[model samples]
Target chain A: MTDLIERPSTEAVPGHGAPTHGDDDHAHGGDHEHHGPSGILKWLTSTDHKVIGINYTVTSIVMMVIGGAFAEVIRAQLVSPTNTLVTFQQYNQLFTMHGSVMIYLFVGPFAFAGLANYLVPLQVGAPDMAFPRLNALSYWLYLSGSITMLLGFFVTGGPAAFGWVGYAPLTSAINAPGAGPDLWIGALMLTGFSAIFSGVNLIATIFYLRAPGMTLFRMPIFTWNMLVTGILILLAFPVLTAGLVMLYCDRHFGTHIFEVQGGGVPLLWQHIFWFWGHPEVYILALPFFGMVTEVIPTFSRKPLFGYKGMVFATLTIAALSLGVWAHHMFTTGAVLLPFFSIMSLLIAVPTGIKIFNWIGTMWGGNLVFSTAMLMAIGFVVTFLIGGITGIYLASPPLDFFTHDTYFVIAHFHSVVMALTLGAFAGIYFWFPKITGKMLHEGWGKAQFWLLFIGTQVFTVPLYIVGLHGMPRRMAVYPNNPSWQNLNEWSSVGALMIGISTLLFVVNVIQAYRKPIPAGDNPWDASTLEWFTSSPPPHHNFVSLPPIRSERPVWDYNHPDAPALAHGHHETATPPAAPAEQEAHA
Target chain B: MKQESVILLLLGVFFGFIGVVYWGWGHEDGGGIMLLGAFLLGMLPGFYYLWWYRKSGGNRPEDRDDATVADGAGVVDAFPSTSIWPFVLGSGCFFIVLALTFGTWLLVPGVGLLLSALIGATAESRRGGNV
Candidate 1:
């Protein structure tokens, strides 16, 4: 294993004219393996991060479709009062699967693992991830975990319908007696391990594998955010792992951890799960935060404002995220109010700072409202609403009123849905770089607006419905006069969101059908990734261009201080690197 | 003290720290935390070697393929031709996932895909074809 990288081997440098040395072997970014699929075996044995990224993406998309279909079923069931398009069992399963897939299986993994798989090494100027084989293992584990979950749908009694949270007493052996909850527990455990492994690999890579002269301050904001996110995962995932193990023991081995009659505390499950769970909210949102940070600067044609502050803010969020886990449990009545409220409210500070930084980044620059920017900007709006609403939820007084009401659903779904949209904006923005094929812009914008309007139309009304006393996750409600109009409007919004997603699928398929050229730097972004070829070569860099700032590629392109060295040595600080001057200026 | 070995060792150490923190401090159930921490101690060299590589030298393109050799010495060839193992592993992944998602019929194909890819790709790599 030491020989894998410790001992150097002889080979001719591909593009560069120089004869290489042992140190260069580890540094040279090139294909150590097949770049694209050549044969059946190559496809299977592939360890390439890019290939794995695509796989994560494709799998998540399929899951998205399945999840969306479930949402559609939910909507269809609620189109009118007392309508039973599906049985209650089916309804429960549908919502359970929908939430589970969207959060655990689809969104977080797709963004973190998928985006990190594709970009993290590139951003940090590494040839590949620190642990490439482990990277492959993470993907495999995730697939298996997802499979274990989907298999429960085919079970005799049906899948776990206790909701994605799997709150106990409900999920305990007695209330939901079956293999259904077992599958959910087991499958999620598998996925959880996969996430932890990927997080560790990514963190190690960023920490250890940076190119020469790429200091911590010189790293891109996206990379910085990922680094913090990685730490959060390291801290957050193990607890979830412990919680799941306990849950599994409780369900299968007759352990009375959450069994109320057996001297178990039901709230313990909430505490344990939310320990991992609340950070997960940021785990999901922070990547989107990174995405918007990348988008606003690139499209606005300005250096990201408050670069160091942004990094600090991101880290602050990760740190503060741990304290706020109890916010999710306020409605349970078991939470310690002042402690939970303070933690929750403190979260708003960093979050608010991030939004300010983003707006500041876009204040005055050559704003190119590309489809990516549009979605990013949209994320700013939607997330602000989500965050503002989050403030209300933080107060125990307000939460008491909103608890289990449509308002809580409205608040959370806005964050989840909008953050996802932000991620999609990032995907569409970077899709070209990853695929070396341009995604259709018109269609991309089309998908964005449809989703944007759809989410607003659907989620906003839920607030009114909640205030009117409509409970969430419930299939049937009496058609009270005030509730009548809001539910209909909400259903209408759900359809729009659905249609928008359909458009997105169509756009992705069409973009793939006809490849369009996305040159090495489509957005002219300053990050290290833009320095490489679109669909970067198997080994990412032939030359680690003299990096004076985090945006080494940007320096390379600028005429006055063009990137100096294109080989193994780091370039000395240039006369006036924009990253340095702009950061200070 | 090649950078690569140092990195591997360093990784082992970091994992050890994580093991202690997560297993030891983080959990109330400390049953396996110590053992897991001990196991993580094994990954130290890998981390150390990785660190050494980044620290010991500058980025010289001329030395890019020299990774398999000792720093500034030896004739070990590091830049072996592209291995297909990861791809095969991924395909095996596809099949396994397929089998899980679709059913047992898919399992046969999945296993076939996984086995053939792993065996063929790995066997060939060990035979020194890419190098």
Candidate 2:
């Protein structure tokens, strides 16, 4: 059978045709070079994709801590309807910074830029990103942008109290007369540039850097999702960047782009922001969908039920995401209600297709309920609730009622929370692969349950209170004594989430303390990533098996029954088994 | 690739049909136009990839199963040995933003540093033989 597989060409593959460099050769060393930079300088100056990825991941985690702290402050303020924890102004800053930090700094960077950076190359069987230095530049810019945004805290009038959206009239020089909004504008512009660079790099890498036989159709679902995500960033972030420039000009040069009194429409800001904002939701989401896609197949021990369907569904979602932006403006009255409403509802079809495909993948398969799988399943349940409620808000009439209420808050949290859950799942699933050590499964499972319960406890009440007409971003509300109970419950849930996060930290610490080496393929997975060692070598794969299908390793392990056996052309002569190849060397 | 393109083309048509419903209902607003635009955009990749696949002999390295990792191994991507342009560029940007609040004096150095950094980064990559 091996000889049959090797009957094609004896010549080396065209793409992987370069001579192997000595391990110590810095000039052309493989990714797993024995001698590389060490210490802080190594992290700061390195262009290695893996190093940059770790930097991004660590930086985003720190930002999450900062953002979560702000959430706690907001929760504390709202615990008792009358402001006790913070003054009204402080409360405004708290919520505004919380939203901004979470959206811009934490989730977007963590998933698309950070996790994608680490795994995409390994999964695609590439050495590094197309532009490694630019990759480093993106991370630095992200870090600087995050710091610049947070610098607003030290300014005279607190950080951009007009909220994360920073609507024009409210954010005007006269309305928000401080350096804070300027800082917000500057921070956004910087981060926007960083995202654009990262997007371009990822798109280029995915398009040009696949291994010998990995084609567009054969790429992992996670890599495909990131590819779409990179496109979204390329298209969407620039609009926001333009908006930020306009906002800055309005604040300084007296430009009237969004100033209604100056003949600039305030709704212009809404149009611009949500144009980016709606797609931004998917920018944070599509990766989660991809992560879940990867997790579902592995744990269920089945080939992904509909690979082509999943890919098309992802593309469909991306294309329609642009059209559904105005659905967010349904209650604004200026938006064309019927048109936006229909588009909003229509976007759900692709999403629904994805959900069904996941269930289909799991149906009647041997399910391994790892912590990662548990979180993936949790995402399905929570995201479904979020999606169903979203349909309610898609209706103009319903939106008018629920607009600016806790119900909207609940709905947004449900979806973003689902994405966050999915990020955790990806982190857990790949932790061993990245670190060469398995996480404490018992603690990981405990963390999942806590977070799962905590999220429901935290946000579900926001729905109840929102339906009861409790407005969002309010420091205190009068004539709503009954709202206090739900608020307290929500705060408790927030605390639980915090605890769950701490447990995750504990799990990481414990895993690292007593490192048990995870071999090359601990999970017996199917992808190219598992074909290499845990924490893959500098140049990712030393040798790869025949890429017969999407599941290369699976094909290698089960040579008799390859996945998708149609049109199995022999591109190159099969090499010895990975272990055998190493032994021969 | 051809089959995947077909799937996307059909999905595009389905979305296009949804857009027609909106258009025929006399709802010719931005929302209706956007729906149509989305469906049209969705069909583009389908058309392009289909064309490329057919033109380029409908088969790619990914289509085969007999290649090994050694077949995939080669020169890992070229990376800069070391460079300071990122820091330079980042500092320039930081100062430029800071100059927004502090003083215009910072802008001159910021722009100067930015230009130098851009040139240096490009030159460094070329010099390092990575590009």
Candidate 3:
């Protein structure tokens, strides 16, 4: 069964995708090895995708550390029910900044600006993103936007403490008067444009820049997910910017957008926020879904069991996500409960399909259980729980009971933890590709276990407490035996997550110190990225591999790799040279 | 008939049907209209991609079902080597954000930096970026 893909054929033909550019079309195209500008200046001004990717990764790592530090401090304050390690205001600031930093600054940049930046171009066999300079601009804007949001801390009023959601009236001038909210608004606008532009750049790159035969179907699932994610970002982020603008006006210009006294409905804020907010959840998860999809198939030594299904699931998820934002607002009495609850429940169908798809990919195959695969499998186990809780919460009846409770906390955090696991999988899977150095497998597995265990430890207790009527975002809880005990337990889990992250950092250091040179295609994987050297050069591929299937590298290696040979119905050869065309004429 | 349209158009029809259902049954709600908006959002892009998927007629070689590794071979584009405009642009954006804090006075430098960055970028693009 493992040796089936070895049928043989040498065929060069254009099928349906690549547009012909007349006679001798392939003879003159823009192919240049633009490896220029070294040193800090190279980083500062470079339009290279690799450099921009590194910029995003390094910055996200820094933000993650800062964000994680905030979480640790929050946990310390929660260690005892009566603990006041921070003032109430300070705790709000800590949690607000932590959530903001992680969501807007860390996870997004890590996944898109970082991982997608590094991989998508290579995966699609493109030289670089379609708009190189715009891509660089996005990085700069994102970097500066990240700084702007953090600058809220230095302001006179302290950081924005109305929660990362920044629900209005609470954020209005009367209730919350501060430059910190203003700064948060400004940072969001900046980052919003950064995200919007990044979305545009990525979508264009995927559409326009594929190598000659890399058809839509043949493109890797990772690239397909990026394309879908790009569309979601393009559609969703602008609403956030619009919402932020309105919030700013309500604060500074004395507008009545969210001010109930001015005949403005404050619930408008929830509507606008969640409209983007729910889709934002998918934006966060989809790329990690792509990453785990890639990792599982590679380690399992199988083509993704339902490749097209995964792609369709991604699109279906994106579309359904847009309609389900009101699920977040079910208890507000402002939304159509039946419509939203149904949409929310409907979304789970596609999401559930993806779960089955991943499982099927690994079912009968030789599984490697590498750290990357471990994290992918970890994602399958963990996110399934998260998804189930989602169904429970989607019902308006249940949500009315659980609104703002730790159940809410457990539900979202479970999803976030699962995605975090997926992200770690991606980082480990591609670290070798990015740095050309293999992280120690032993340490990688250790990190995965700590995170996986820590996630369960931290979130499982929250579920129990949540079901038992514990609340979220609380600075102080009455010293009840049940709540305090569980809260103490969860803080220990948070510490474990912190330790796992530290282990990851140490793993990187050890890899660099010992220097395990990961050759091109370290996993014997089957994508175009592996076709080039680890840490691919200024130009990604030096030579061509006939991209007849999704697993081009595998096909290239095995020539007639089984049923793949029979599938090559491509009959139209590439456009002839002018001389050959004249001869034919 | 394209795969993207199948998924996207299905979404559009769902939203459209739900929008109509919502408006008919839940007339006083903003969500009914929003569902209509969702239908538009889904269909407009859905139709556009479907149209382009049809119109472009030629996809990148990778779009083909049977395309081989050789079919994808080509000279790649010359990616830009360096551009100072991003720094200029970022700085301009920074000033713009600062203006929100300090007052309208900061917009002077911000707008100026932005305009210059725009000019520099336009010039750089026109020069083919080798300069």
Number of the top-ranking candidate, with TM-score as the measure: 3
Please tell me which model should have the higher lDDT, number 2 or number 3. 3
Off by over 4 Å in 2: A1-34, A560-562, A565-585, B1-77
A396-514: candidate 1 lDDT, tens digit per residue: 99998888898988998889878868888888778878877777778878888888888898889888889887888888889776676787888888898888888887877887887
Superposed model 1: Cα runs more than 4 Å off: A1-39, A561-585, B1-131
Residue range B12-82, candidate 2, lDDT tens digits: 67668766875676464544555565566558866976897799884544444444544544444455644
Order the numbered candidates by lDDT, best leading.
3, 2, 1
DockQ of each: 0.11, 0.26, 0.39
lDDT of 3 by residue, A57-82 (tens): 88998999999999999989988887
Off by over 4 Å in 3: A1-35, A565-585, B1-15, B28-38, B45-60, B66-78, B129-131
Deviation from truth (RMSD, Å), model 2: 6.5
Top-down DockQ ranking? 3, 2, 1
Residues A309-410 of candidate 2 have per-residue lDDT tens digits of 888889888867776677877776776677778778887898999999899888876777888899999999999989999999988889999999999999
What are the interface RMSDs of all the models? 9.2, 8.7, 9.7
